[model samples]
Target chain A: MRRFSAYEWVRTAVTIGIALALGYLVLVFTVDDPNGAFKWFLWGPLSRMRRIVELIDYTIPLIFAGLAVSIVFQAEIFNIGAEGQLFMGAVGATFAALYFPQIPVIHVILVAAFAMLVGGAWASIPAYMKAKWNASELVSSLMMNYVAFFLGLYFINYHMRDLKAGYLVSYKFPETAWLPRILKRYNLHAGVFIAVGFVFLVWFFLYRTRFGYEIRMMGFNKNFAMFSGIKVNNVVLYAQIVSGMVAGLAGAVELMGLYKRFVWQVSPGYGFDGIIVALLARNNPLLVLPAAFLVGYFRTGAYVMSRMTGIAPEIVTTLQAVIILLITAEAFLEFWKRRKIIREAMKAEGGDVQ
Target chain B: MNEIARSILSAEFVYSVIRVSTPLIFAVMGALLSEIAGVINIALEGMMLMAAFWGVIVSAFTGSAWLGMLAGLASAVLLALALAYFHLNLRTNLILAGIALNLFASGATVFLLYLISGDKGSSASIKSYVLPRVDIPLLKDIPFFGDALSGHHILTYLAFAAVVFVQYLIYRTPLGLRLRAVGENPEAAESVGISVRRVRYIALVLSGLMAGFGGVFLSMGYVSWFARDMTSGRGFIALAAQALGGKTAIGGMLGAMLFGLAEALSYTFQAIRIPSEFTNMMPFVFTLIALAVYARSVIARHRKAPSSSQPLEENTET
Candidate 1:
């Protein structure tokens, strides 16, 4: 390994140390057996291959959602509606799966694609409103979250609710349409490969494509981009639509891969989690893969920790929050303080060369 | 149709408007301050959610609605500080910070709820303190509008008062002038010896206080209990109102009233033949239309004023 800089090591050490410390505090305060909580927080998820597989399963959708969000962020459009877009995607995909129980497997794949398109279309409403009306995407997109939510609830409750389930879940999707598993006797599916492939595709598009360069250019300086003859509004709108579609695909894949039916009335905070994943990755679409996996690992660990030690799973979320806050603020503060320290040290040394 | 029209004018519809408008009144007031200072606060949703969750939790623990309200405000203020610190001090992206905070708020609250109650969905397990209605005896005797408007949670009166207070703060004070100057042109304001950061920080904190009250009112005054994500989408609606209001206090109030009216009408029309889903969507649909209309106006204004690039880009498109 290359020799590490002091600041680099400090940041790494601080991030990991703070995460453990916060997790321990929560466990000690909240759990009946603090030691057990600590042990569980550290190693409970790794105790079983099954649990590791579950984490990977969770990461699949999150990775897609993260890519969706990062795409919009790259274009400098703050699309907060990913969660709503994801839900709409689920709704679209679920309906397709439900309505076409007789269709061949190949046609089922086409239907899933169509569902993602619907998600993009749903997300595009706010995108267009944002581009054309000067409406706040943060607000309009957020409002769409509720609209999508209640709309889903309405469908589950009225249009597609499964009576046998005794809860507000949709009717079972055809087994033929289920996403095929990639591994033997594991919950992990082909979705993981698809999600990984997408990350690479996004990386290529962002770094190698002319349109991607223009999008980044616009995000950096809208005036400069406009001056250089990039179609700023069109790029923004299209980015949002694509982002929404990606999020929607995440939902479709998630429903097909896991649940036999659509049951969620609201998100389990997946869309919102995508935002954090994107942020932690610094809005790089390809990096979102690892970011999403890390988040998924923590979420699974948190759930496991909750069960093992009777601590709330929320402590995991708190730890995540603190981590993101620290990371986002980390480099800037270090840069400023380091600059000051170096200035003082140079003055003391009479400006001698190293 | 005639009978429906008659029922629409009934007192129950009017009361529904008042009830729905209560939290929104505080939300609009909160959003107005932030918009004036040019801080786009998506965290209002998260703030209100935290406040509502903690308001009920504290009230259940302490058995005092007053304490709950105080807790609500405290929670929101802390969140406000985080947003302000990140946006101003670290000079991070405001919207990204907002998204992070909102997710933290939602997940953190739910996690805490499960810890406290062993339940994930609602806070009904706690016997929280609920705010008492203030029956203004003399005002109740004044007839017609008096009794209809008088006996409400004290926050209702405070919300209306905040409208006037925020208006004065925006228009009548030197601080307000400096705040507006900072929001309109940060570089120009900096040239004149004003700290853009300080103005934004103040606006965010004040916005926090307003949203905090909105949270308190939801748990302590209106519903007397908190549910998971109870503030729902009201904060976003308030943001919409800020846009629809043209960033003016009066415009905000008017926009809030219109949204409030849509929400109230949805409840009323729920009894009618209209599908509840479609009716429930009216407020948001109207907000979308309002935003489109607002955009059209901004484009029109840009066409009229060819010299102004700032207004065309920042205020008109967000």
Candidate 2:
């Protein structure tokens, strides 16, 4: 309920402002033409219609990733298994596309359900460990990611390798499985609608549902929730499984909507980006849209900047790091802000009743 | 098949295990110190990255491996100070701060690399000075021991020595006593006039120094150049090793060795024509299985000994 306090908003804004300023300083010291490069980074993505479309297309997957992270983060479990879960989800989608070439509209739904199950199954590995043994899910989940990656690679190399392609890529998805394109030249697909629909769905589920309340209560205080008759283990397990399904859905949509075939050599790194997105959104599903939009803007602008300037686009990573550090730093400007607030309150109550 | 079996049993395999473990050992020492002092530093990866990048660049310019090593340590120490300032002073979440630092280090290293060398992948153009290898006279003359223990990077010897050094520092010294006291009961330690923040800062700094050595070794000893994400997941693995060791310095070293053995086995598997992907996943799978088993046994023990579980519950509460 106090999620959007005025003080918190002030701190968040200041954090982002400082991060951007420092990012410009980095560019100024590195590049020969700093102002020119800055201009390109700030406005390049919005300059052309095609780049804008690309940004929208890119944001669709990011929204799902952010929502994925937001759900589990709300449950107080730090799970980086989304990366691995995404890989499995994509693998499941590929299996569906290659094998189930019969149904028309139903094939898309089948692929999604299968991908969701695969992703949930992958995430349950770390969840089961944490629930059963009190193991730190952070390390186990990260380790599980590598296992998923290698297993996925094994599948691609041995099971689904198309020899005619001359690369480690799987067979193409049937036409029936394709999400109808919104534009002929651009990549605007129905996945955008799906991504937006999920934002609302997650919002409703997290706030309006009994299970969600239990998950949040457990996250707030495990001992308190356990005393209140909540099943702590089940909440922990289901939260992560639900989060993985969102991430898995993102993987499926991104792969089918963008690429002609499944050719990911490594985890697409959307999982890590999702952490940044969730942090930016303050773990609010409703805020995921704008948070993901901002990241998509940065990624697109960075690509354009890298092409025009010699500077690497990894500058955005540094920028986001500063943002995270300052945003989460509780005492960063707290003393000053508190003093000013007290001053205002006293001034307004000079002739106060005791 | 016979040749594969023979190669796996050779002294070279043992040598490779120690060689590969050098970085992890250094990192585990750092992880153990921070963890023992009640600070969770997941930024070892970032510290290593900054150190490795600075080590290579400074050595190339200064022509002294020692100076390069100092520069590396200094950079890591600086990073440690920032983390301490953010977490201890600013009240930032320790884990989140560590994650940010990792991203910062990864991005900043690449950004700086481009500025310095006009390249984004590696600092290969820099003629970085590699630290000299050390060979003890007596050990070098021995048959199997010579092959397995001699002629390693100087930092490799330092890593083993560091294990003993940290073991003594943690269990024998007055400072170590204060550190443990603060970690166990910060309020009680503060009542006794111990500064919890100061002790934690020192712990972070020392761990940074240890992690710095690991990073420096990566660039200046194991290889002659800095590459992107070269430390990979070794930093996280070090944290796992520390936890597995029951948070003791010696136990942490043994845990690191187990992981190192797994890594060495993976490398050997590649020689026998196994799918590299399958073999590459072995260490991670081993870590997961090992961690789960360890966690389960610890839980079972706590259930059996109800009195002992109090401290653990208190540990979780904080």
Candidate 3:
């Protein structure tokens, strides 16, 4: 693990300070009770046991999405088709749940397997283009996300929408297809165990496997990898496929675990949220858990704060952007800090000479 | 088939096509400039969204349309500079930084909108001014052509005029040469005393300014209100349009019009029971296909080159 230096400490503190100040200013200008809103935002999530459970529940999909993103980060390719793949993953699970009624755990497994397949297939669109033509994965993934979004909407509104449900929603999953909640209150699904298992599983695959070595090599330097006799194109394809599966699995697990019916008129943004999680973890699958929890905590607090105080939760997004900017900034405040250090060092040497 | 022909063959359809494409043409031009300068401005969407929000707010508050337009352009240029600062100086990945800025605009716009109007969706509560239209003396007299071209939104006219202006600036100037040289071969340009960073900064700022006009048009001229996510992926579409045009102003305008026509088709066809969702997905799907085809051609051309060693982008796929 990389230890945090003083520079890193200051970087994080400063990033947080800037984000909070911006968020606080928004609150000051709008809400009559800014401090009260801030207090609720900071402490409201932990005020109730139910909220804590929901927060943990919410973190589950983030782990899967983070792992998915981190896997692609291994290849130095920004293939964010996970958003689309997740949408298709849920659709895949819906197909399985709606059609293939089976015995206890087998039904869930069947649904999950189909979801993974769909997700991987969705990711293949961008992966194939990138490998075959060197097309911009960034652009392809972005365009594909909108395609997936509208496709999902069409599927729900046309194929699976319950006509008698009074709104756009799907038929309820059979009890056998449910993810088997671990807690009676809020949400404690078996997906939590799966999430933890995958974290360690990804950690092992990335560090102990030859494929992982190839991915890391390609990411660090593509030409070097090519010179080292690595098949760059194949690695990109395989890495994206696996990553897509994980993202797709996340969508399925979230659907089966959380609600009785599919009511997502707009696609859930867990896929994009995964980018932040992976970034915070520095693209390390092992560290994604903590990063996912951190994001989930803020999201939970936002939800609680909004629920109680009527302040919009969109403020966290601005904070997220600020953090991303600071985190990715290689030379942020570097020159000034280094110059100060050099001056102090020279002064110390002069004192010693005297 | 008959209905489709009737709907599309009208003068009204032509007007709507130009109307729908006005923002896209401006945006595609911006994307073209940035691409030519070797920087793909992915945050065009965010910048547009910011401009749209600011234009509406400033116009509503100050009661001056011109000031609103300036505010819109200023906000967008500022964001562009921020992206340039992070990508060029701070060493952040361009794609990530762009995405982050897009998110920032998406969030901050809504945050500000909610704060100002106590509504998170649209800024309709505030009464905003819209720019005036011009009727060309002879053009307006030419029946069908006049109905299609004359008395359109002020920005709509500026959009087409801006294309001609950009085409001239790109093909006839020293700055254009510097921009192209920097994009084509940064090290060579740097060695030749051309500051690659400065050229790119200029390109990005210009890109910002052009996109800002497109954004302000959306809020002030298209409709006198700002809506959340109103740009609706037009920025991404503009990137695709640029790719389709192979990074040229004229070609990009053609591509934008093509997609704008697709958009107009969706709207016209909605009366015939065609789903809007499917129509909405057309441009994005087209963008993906366009990128693939564009990249394939670029790669094929690269293979035929004498020294087939240069990468398409720095640390991108190559």
The prediction achieving the highest TM-score against the true structure is 2
Per residue, candidate 1 scores C-alpha lDDT tens digits across A1-354 of 113355544654576578779778866776678887677667766888888888898898889888888888877787788998888888888888888655667745865796789789988998897777666676778788878877877776788888889877999888866888877987888888889999988777777898778778877888899999998888878888888888888888888888867968657678878877876666787668878988888888877777776666766766776666666664444775588689889898985763
Better of 1 and 3 by lDDT: 3
The digit string of per-residue lDDT tens for model 3 on A1-354 reads: 245566766776787677778777878877899998988777877888898888889899999999999999878889987888898899878878888967798999999999999999999889998889888788898888999889878877888878998988888888888998787766778999999999999888787899988888898899999999999999989889989999999988988988756778776888888998898888888889998998888788888888888877888888888888888788987986798799989999999999
- Residue-wise C-alpha lDDT for candidate 1, range B35-124, written one tens digit per residue: 787787778888988899899998889888888889989999899999999878876667666766776887788878888887888888
Candidate that scores best on DockQ? 3
Candidate 2 segments whose C-alpha is farther than 4 A from its true place: A166-168, A340-354, B309-318
Q: Each prediction's TM-score against the native?
A: 0.92, 0.96, 0.94
lDDT of 2: 0.87
Give DockQ per model, in order: 0.49, 0.68, 0.69
TM-score of model 1 vs. true structure: 0.92
**How many times do residue backbones clash in model 3?**
1
Query: Which residue runs of candidate 1 sit more than 4 Å off their true CA positions?
Result: A1-13, A101-104, A330-332, A336-354, B137-139, B273-276, B307-318
Give per-residue lDDT, candidate 2, residue B147: 92
Alpha-carbon local distance difference test for all models: 0.80, 0.87, 0.86
**Regions more than 4 Å wrong, model 3:** A1-10, A333-354, B306-318
Interface-residue RMSD per candidate?
2.7, 1.9, 1.4
